[model samples]
Target: ASNAYGNSVGRLVRLAVIILFIYAGLLGLTGLGFKIVPGGFLPTQDRGYAIVFAQLPDASSLDRTQAVVDKISKIAHETPGILNTVEFAGFNLFGG
Candidate 1:
C-alpha cells in the first residue's frame, strides 16, 4: 500500500491536475447548492424587543437629545404591535 501511494505521489503533474479539478468541482457544487437553498443560512426569528437609537450632532445638548428621544418613544408607543419602549438620554449601550 505504501509503495502504491508513493508511486501515485511521484506523479506530481497528474496528482496536481486531479486535485485542482476536484477542488473546482466542489466549489461549483457549493455555488449550486446555495442557489437551490431558500431563505439563506439563518431564518428570521422575532425576539420580543427592539432598540431605537436617536443620534444628534456631536455637539448637541442633552436637552436636545432628550427631546428627540421623547418624540421617538411617543411615536413608537402609538404604533401598533409595539408593547413597550424604554428610553435613555446621553447614554449609549454600545459606546459604554
Candidate 2:
C-alpha cells in the first residue's frame, strides 16, 4: 500500500542509480574466475558427517526394534572415541 506508491518518487530515482551501480560491478568482474564457479556448490564433493539410519518393516515389533537398536548401540560404544551414543528405537527412544 504505502510502500507501493506512498513514498517519494525521489526514492525511485535513487533506486535506479543503485541498480546501475550493481550492473556496473557485475560487468566489471567479467572474465575473472572469481565471477563464477563452473560446477555446483560442492563440485569437489568433500563432505563429512556421521549418522546411522536403519529401517525395519513398518510392522516390526517394539521388542525386535529394541534388540536391533541395542546391538547398534553396543557396537558403537565398543568402537574407540565414541564418547556418547544416543539411540532412537522406533518412535519410543526413552522406552515406552
**Model 2: runs farther than 4 Å from truth?**
1-49, 92-96
List, residue by residue over 1-96, the lDDT tens digit for candidate 2. Answer: 667674766688899999999998887787565557665565566543346766778789989989998999899889886777878777743344
Question: Judged by TM-score, which candidate is best?
Answer: 1
TM-score of each: 0.50, 0.42
* Tens digit of per-residue lDDT, candidate 1, span 8-96: 88898788999999999999999998888775555556476787787788989999999999999999999998998888999977894
TM-score of model 1 (CA atoms)? 0.50
Error of 2 at 57 (Å): 1.6
Model 1: residues with Cα > 4 Å off, grouped in runs = 1-45
